[model samples]
Target chain A: MNANIPSEVLPILLILIGTIFSLLSAIGLVRLPDVYTRSHAASKSTTLGVLFILVGTFLFFLLEEHYFSIRLFLGIFFVFLTAPVAAHVLVRSAYRSNVALAEESVQDDLKDFIHTDSKKTKDAEVNDTD
Target chain B: MIEIMLICSLIFLTLSIIAIMYRLVKGPSASDRVQALDTLGINIISGVAVFSVLMRSTGFFEVILLIGILSFIGTIAFARYLERGVVIERKHPK
Candidate 1:
C-alpha cells in the first residue's frame, strides 16, 4: 500500500493532519464548559498537533533541502516536554485557587485529601497559638 | 499541489488562532485565560512552522524555540502566582 504514493505527498499529509487536530483543540477550548476540561483539550491535542507538524516540517527540510535541522528536533522535544507540565500547573493552580468545577462533574477524589490537609494545618496553627 | 495544501493549512491555523484568542479574551476565569494563552503559544509555533515551509527558509526555527521557552516560563509564573499570590519567595531568617 505504501509503494503507490509518491514520496512528496507524505509531509503535506502530516501537515494537514496536524492542522485539523490543532483546530479541534482550539474549538474545544472555546466549547468546553470550564477550565479543567478546556485545559485537557489545550494540552493533549495541541501537543500531538504540534508534534505532527514539527515532524512533518523536519522531514520536508530533510528531504527537499537535504538539510538536517537540529532546531526542528529541539522544538519537537521542547514541546513534548513542556506542554503537559504547563497544563498540569495550570489545573493545579486553578484547583487550589478555588476555581469552580463544572456543575456536571460527577466526582472529586481530591476533596478528601485537601480537607484533611487543611485540618492538619489548622491544628498546627492552634498549637502555635498556645 | 503542495503549495496549495500548505496555503489551506495556513488558513486553518489562522482560524484556530482566532478561536484561541477569543477564549483568551472572554474566559470566565483566570485559569481559562492562561490555558488559552498557552494554547495560543503552541498555535503560534505551528503557524511559524507553516510559514517557514511556505518561505522555504530555516530562519524562523529560532523564533519557534524562543516562543516555546518564553511561553513555558510565562505559564509557570502565572500558575505560581495564581496558586500562592506570589510568583517568587524569599526565605526569612528565624
Candidate 2:
C-alpha cells in the first residue's frame, strides 16, 4: 500500500475534530441541569462523537485497503439509527411519569394538560353533587 | 496517527466523568442519581471502544455489548424504582 499524504491527512483531521466535539459534549453533560437537559448532552454529543470516530476509523482502514473498513461503516450506520431512538424512549418515559423539571424552567407546553385535568375533576365533583 | 488528540480527548472525558460522579454521589433526588449513572454508563462504553482501537484488537467488542446490555437493564430498573419505589416484585398475588 502506497502512503499518500492526502489520504492519511484527512482521517487524522476527522479524528481530531470528532474527539474535540465529544469532549465538548461531555462538558455540556456535566454542566447541564435537570435530566432532560443532561440527556441532550449525553445523546447528541455521544452520537456525533461516535460518528466522527467511526469516520476516522473508516478512513484509516480505507487508506490501508483493509477489509474491515466495511465493518466500521456498518457500525456507524447502526449506531446512528439506534442512538436517537433509545434517547427518545428514555426521555418520553420520564415525561410520562411526570418527572419534575427545574424550578426556573419556563415554556412548559404540558401545562394545559395539567390545567384541564384539574378542571375535569372539579366538573365531576359538581355533577356528583347534583 | 493523531495519538496526541486522542489522549487529550480521553483526559477531557475523565474530567467530565469526575463531574458526573460528583452528581451521582451528591444527588438529592433519585432521578438525578439515575441520570448520572446513565451518563457514566455511556462514558464507559465509549472508553472501551477507544481502548479497543488503541490495543488494535476486536476482543473489546464483547465488553461493549456487555456494558450496553447491563446499562440498559440498570437504567430501566432505576427508572422503575424511581416511579414505584421498589426494585423487585412481591410474592403476593394480585
Candidate 3:
C-alpha cells in the first residue's frame, strides 16, 4: 500500500503477493489432516504464487532492464501446464492405493465410481489392482 | 527500497520452504512426500526469482525452468510408482 515511490513498487508488491501465497500454502500443507486436502493446497495456491512471482519478475526486467525473456514466459506456461496434472496424478494414485479420507469429511462423491466392485469392468479392476 | 522488498520476499520463501520440509520429513505417506516435493519446487522457483531480482540478473531464468521440469517429472514418477508399484511398466510379449 506504500505508494510514495510509485512506478517500480508494483513489481515488488506483486512478488510480495506471491511469497504470501506460498506462505499460505505451506501453512495449509502442514495443518491439513488428510492427503487429499493437503494436495489441494499444495497444487493450487503455490501455482498461483509462482505465476505471480514470474510475472512480476518479467515486468521488472522489462521495465528496468529493457530485456525481454522468452524463458520466463515459458516458465509460466510450464507451471500452468504441469501443476494441476501432477497434483491430479498424485492424488489419483493416493486414492488408488487405499488412502483413507479424513474423518471430518462426510461426503465422498467419488465413492460409487471409485470403489464399487460391480461398477468396475474386468480390465479396469486389473489395471486398478495392478 | 526494491532491494528491501525483494529480500523480505526471499525471507518469506525460505520460511515457507522450511515448513514444507517439515511435512516432507514427517509425512506419513508416499503421496504426502510427493506433494511436499511439488510444493517445495514451486517455492524454490519463486525463491530463485526473488534472488535473481535481488541480484539484478537474468542468469537464473533457466534454473527456474529446469526446476519446474524436474519437479513435474519427479512427481509423476513418484505417483506412478505409488499407484502401479513400478515407474516403468514393461509389456509382456504375447
Report DockQ per prediction, comma-separated: 0.91, 0.29, 0.92
Better model by DockQ, 1 or 3?
3
Q: Positional deviation of B76 in candidate 3, in angstroms?
A: 0.6
Q: Give stretches of model 1 more than 4 Å off.
A: A1-5, A116-130
lDDT of 2 at B92: 50
Can you write out model 2's per-residue Cα lDDT over B1-94, one digit (the tens) per residue? 4456556656766776787788788765666677667667666655665555555566665665566667667777766665545778675536
Q: Rate the local accuracy (lDDT) of all candidates.
A: 0.91, 0.66, 0.90
Q: What is the C-alpha RMSD, rounded to one decimal, of candidate 1?
A: 3.1
Which regions of candidate 3 fall more than 4 Å away from where they truly are? A1-5, A117-130
Which candidate achieves the best TM-score against the true structure?
1
**lDDT per residue as tens, model 2, A1-130:** 4557676667656666766666677677667777788788867887787677667756666674453644455556666665666566566556645767877788789768865875797798689666
Count steric clashes of candidate 1.
0
Model 3, A1-130: lDDT tens per residue?
5744665777888999998999999999999999999987898999999999999999888887789999999998999999999999999999988788899998998887776743465567689668
Clashing pairs in 3: none
- Comparison by lDDT, 1 against 2, better one: 1
